[model samples]
Target: DAGVTQSPTHLIKTRGQHVTLRCSPISGHKSVSWYQQVLGQGPQFIFQYYEKEERGRGNFPDRFSARQFPNYSSELNVNALLLGDSALYLCASSLGGGNTEAFFGQGTRLTVV
Candidate 1:
């Protein structure tokens, strides 16, 4: 059983360009969440989708968006990219709501160059 898988482990984009990051959750997992991690700082929650519905969001700008598919796969979209957006985009999956243990993927390293 795959814990969590993220594609295009690395990405290079110029400012103002849009990018989409993908993730696949473990079998039987019903919740998928996205987090942004910048070096020297902790991971910040971006979005959480449960059963295909968004359940929570973080203090990120409107440029960040995400959605979960019926199969439990997820995608994180960032629009109008900026150099500050360069970071590791991580996806985590959990069984369900309330105190569930989450599992994370390797993360996509987005570089704004």
Candidate 2:
């Protein structure tokens, strides 16, 4: 079965533009999380959308948001993008919320020019 999948593998956007990145979790997984990985830094947690409850979000600005669908897929949306937002956006899936083992996708690399 597929572990986790993300779309568009690569993207380019301009400052002030808005972009949406999509993710599909593994079969039967109910929780999805978004992370941003900048060069030379670790992955920073962005948002977690669970099947049954609200999990948590990172310290990102209001421009960042996400939603989980009934099918357990997810989308991360960023509005008014900035050059600082250029990074690898990762999606992870788990059996449930909290510290469960998460399976991650290769991620969508976003470049804000």
Highest-scoring model, lDDT: 2
What would the TM-score be for candidate 1 when compared with the true structure? 0.97
Candidate 2's error at 103, in angstroms? 0.5
Please give the distance, in angstroms, between residue 88's alpha carbon in candidate 2 and its true position after superposition. 0.3
User: How well does candidate 2 match the true structure, expressed as C-alpha RMSD?
Assistant: 1.0
Worst 10 contiguous positions by lDDT, candidate 2: 48-57
Compared with the true structure, what per-residue lDDT tens digits does model 2 show for residues 14-107? Answer: 9999999999999999999999999999999999999935599899999998999889999999999999999999999998886459999999
TM-score (C-alpha, index-matched) for candidate 2:
0.96
**Residue-pair clashes, model 1:** 0
The C-alpha stretches of model 2 lying farther than 4 A from their native spots are: none
